[model samples]
Target: MQFLGAINFSLPLLASATETADSSMVLAAVLLSLVVIYLASKVGGELSNRFGLPPVLGELVSGVVVGVSVLHLLVFSEGGTDSNLIITFLQGTAGLSPDAAAGVFAAQSEVISVLAELGVIILLFEIGLESNLKDLMAVGIQASVVAVVGVVVPFTAGTVGLMTLFGIDALPAIFAGAALTATSIGITSKVLSELGRLSSREGQIILGAAVIDDVLGIIVLAVVASLAKDGAVDVSKVVYLIISASGFLLGAIALGNFFNKSFVAIADKLKTRGELVIPAFIFAFVMAYLAAAIQLEAILGAFAAGLVLEETDKRKELQKQVIPIADMLVPIFFVTVGAKTDLGVLNPAIPSNREGLIMATFLILVAIFGKVITGFVVFGQPGINRLAIGVGMIPRGEVGLVFLGIGSSIGILSKPLEAAIIMMVILTTFLAPPLLRIVFPDSEAVGVASELILNTSGTPLAVESPTAINSKSNDAANPEATPDGH
Candidate 1:
């Protein structure tokens, strides 16, 4: 009996040891995955920047190279039994059996997926920080008109076209159309800043429109995601989503004045490291939790929190501090998005791929034409490079990917449809920067416009004289000048 008791105690210890080893293997697999991801992001991003394209494009291309359609190094279960090279590598090095490796792979993927989700939340928060509510309001009616048109036209046209032309169902078409409505403010704003057009009238309108577009896109995403969950579109859910999204945004802004003060006071009194950022994230996460509780996207709450915090005196420091954290996480979101995408669906040798290729072409055209037309609708601004405004709006960039990721997650998007949307995002993102430079060719005019002062009405007040510019040379640089482009 004493010997039997000893065996029982030893059995529990052996089981605990086995569990610890399994966890260690899982962590090793995850670390290996991150190694691949970070290397791909850096190499891809660097190459993209070298070619005057967005770094995100490079990360995506790298993901494609490392993902299912190519090397299979970063593949997931959704990639359809495509062997993960990481798992194989671990098995060879760590002496794990195939069965054990599979379990490790699943757990590793889940952890990475969670990290990717957090990356997106932080990305939205950073976007909210950069989007100044005051600037959005300051841009006034023209920007509003442009933003509204930019969203309405693409969404309406994409959804209707997909339904009519392809005989696609309503939800998938809506998902695809909703993807079209995003304007990658990050991509567009970078091109504008590089061209020194960021402060220009056309630039302001583009930036303002993009900000509104982000808000609208999130609402649409929440609705579609909710609808996808139920597998049917309910009228009541649609109405509720619109009201909740709008109320969440409006309520956040309404409470901003009070929250800003309390946040600063709390932050200042902490007298510890991360005083400002920790509390900010706590608020953001709580808001994200609340949004999820209300059946909305958690990202919506994160974005709203960023918007409110942008009003605080700590906005600039908070923006600076958020960058390192974003840098660490955001690439995972982007790269994982690329990894899950199966480019095999786009192969023309396969008969079924023909439809996807055709749809992709249609989406590319709609993505470009839809946004370009918004610039022409600027009613009061004469010779405002309506073309430039339109071109600036063309790149869907990371924002489109976010939409694609959510759709893909809910399984609302078919394989072909998903591949097509990815193609549209890639092409639009690639084409926009150079196209923007071409349309806004006169650098001298851009330089002049950069110096022009705008009234509260967003009308160009006057071109500042040379002497007036000289007088302000000693003034401190505008704290808002260098925004986080990501």
Candidate 2:
């Protein structure tokens, strides 16, 4: 009788186990999601090319499609969609219980985090490689003014707007505004390159301003993070971060200069099969690691590394090699960012006491308006519209997403607030390219200045060659020489 009872109990338990296993169908959904992401990216890339928009815009849009805000295809929600099949399967294979799944997910996220970091590093490095230091110097004053105005106006406006309109507390409001300070150099560079304006005076100014903006944004994010955690600003920490950042920049410049000379010397000495390429990559990785160890942003080191090698003959070859890797990994970073955002939290059904929608709108407007107004501060420049320059600087891209992720991870932003910030990021990124194309229409005649020639006062010196002057005079006198030069 006892044996019969044991068998009866075992049968029900086994049946219950089978039902539970069937319910945990998250693995299938995850595989399907990845496939969708890949297909969407390819299609998006083609469409972007056809439309003359940056391929990134299309990729981001594709992410939105698979994101929680849209078809609910990829994101795994608790008790909602069965989109976590792959995660579940992996967890099961690893012998992780449901309790351990969170840990596994966290670990997986860390890997994604590293790849995303590498993508941005390479992106910034590429920017540094292409940058004209002299051009940046030429526009330094104007760029500084614009960047300052852009940062201050948006930060002030966002803070006030959030406080008044949404009744959010001071810290959150500050954070919301701080998030908007990040400007995406990558997107702007791509747009300018596409429009054939990258070498133009306006493009140079925008690029210079963006570099400053990035540095400032990092400082601001650090401050906000500290404030949100402690409820009071740590002046020492702020100073430390500033000092560290400054030191890193100076050190990178010195070290990079030395390394470049030595590297070139070594490459010249040893003309082996692939010695140069291997060393270059190793240098990049080591600098990146060192920067992290020093508590400075790794991308800064990478950028400096690129700058060190900029004048070298091998620069173009290195860029070509690095760009492919960046292209493959960068999208993964962005898509993961999209995936991490839980859009369902933004649904109005949630009884959260926070005014998410209004706050989000306010922050987004502040972000757009802040950058837009900075364009008007171009400082007596002519031949380019100021509004266009400002608009080009509006997109926040990877940097803003990084800030949002950090904030969410540390509890500075609740889930709904995080979702709202991601929305703002996507909106600004999506709008920038089309807006830029519309305002700065393509023109073959307007070529960007090839080199930055600056006077003692840090102004762009108007260097006029005798030949150019004579040619202009000749064109005025003879119609044939003009070629519509006017």
Candidate 3:
């Protein structure tokens, strides 16, 4: 009896030890993933800069190089980690058993995904800090028009064209159309900042319009998603989304001054090292949570928080403090976006993929032309780079993927349709940075000067090329800078 009791106790101890080791391996996996992500971001960014393109493009390309499409250094759970180098390394060197490998990869992927979400939140918040709320307001009407046109044009054309040309069903066509409406504000804003035009007249209009486009896109997504799920539109749910999104943005701005003062007061009382930024982040996170609770994107809340806080006396100091944190987190978002994309859909050799390739060509044209026309519709901005404004709205990036994921989950999209949307997103995303540079050639000469850093006076300063800054001081000196100086 005593020998049996001893055996039982040892079994429990062995199980507990195994659990502990698995936990440690998860952390190690996350750490190694970060190492790979950081290296990819930096190397890609540097090479992009060298080639006279935005560093963001480089980061994305680097992500592709390391992701499932290429080296398989960074992959997710969706396609399985059978070919993932990181998982293989863990199995080989960390003594991770085959049984535990799947669980570890899943946990690791979830952690990275969460971190990437946080990275975008920080990126939006930082953009808001750099933007002037009043300027955004000034361009509100023109922006509203642009946004409406952007949504209506592509959505109508894409939906109608698909049904007519490809003989697709109404529901799947609508889903694809809806995907074209949202401009990925995160991607466009970063490129604008990099080009030193974030405060320009056209830039303000694009920013204001993009924000509106996001709200509209979300509402469309909700309606279509409801329809896809139940085969009928939920009228009340659509109403709630519209009202809630509009109210959240308006309410946040209305309450800005009060919240700004309260934030500053809280910062004043604290003598701790991170007194300013810590409180600021707390407010941002709370606002983000509230936005999500209302069925809006969390990044919108962070952006709203940044807009409110920008009115405070501590704006510059807050920007300075937030930079380092953004540097660490934001690349995770960008690189993860790049890594998640599977470029295998582009190949035309496979008989099944040939249809997707043809359909993708059509979607690409519609996506580009639909957005490009929105710029021409903007009234009263004389000599404005209409092309840039339209081009700015082109890249669908992560937002397009969300639509694709939902449609795929519901089994609404056929194979060719799904691949077509993916191709549209990939091409538009990769094309925007270089296209922005092409349209704004003057800005390209002084693009490096656009990166913001702190001077001795504790105010944000833009370094410039001697000749370029002389002729374009106003635009070059625009205070809206990106985190990590990209």
Q: What are the models' TM-scores?
A: 0.76, 0.75, 0.90
- How do the residues 73-180 of candidate 3 rate in per-residue lDDT, one tens digit apiece? 889776544677898899999899988887677767767777888888888888888787887998899999999999999999999989999999999999999888
Best by TM-score: 3
lDDT, model 3: 0.81
Give the TM-score ranking, best first: 3, 1, 2
Predicted model with the maximum lDDT: 3
Over 4 Å off in model 2, which ranges?
Answer: 1-38, 70-82, 85-108, 254-259, 271-273, 341-354, 402-419, 443-486
Q: Which 10 residues in a row give candidate 3 its minimum summed lDDT?
A: 1-10
List the candidates ranked by lDDT, beginning with the highest: 3, 1, 2
RMSD of 2: 11.9
Clashing pairs in 1: none
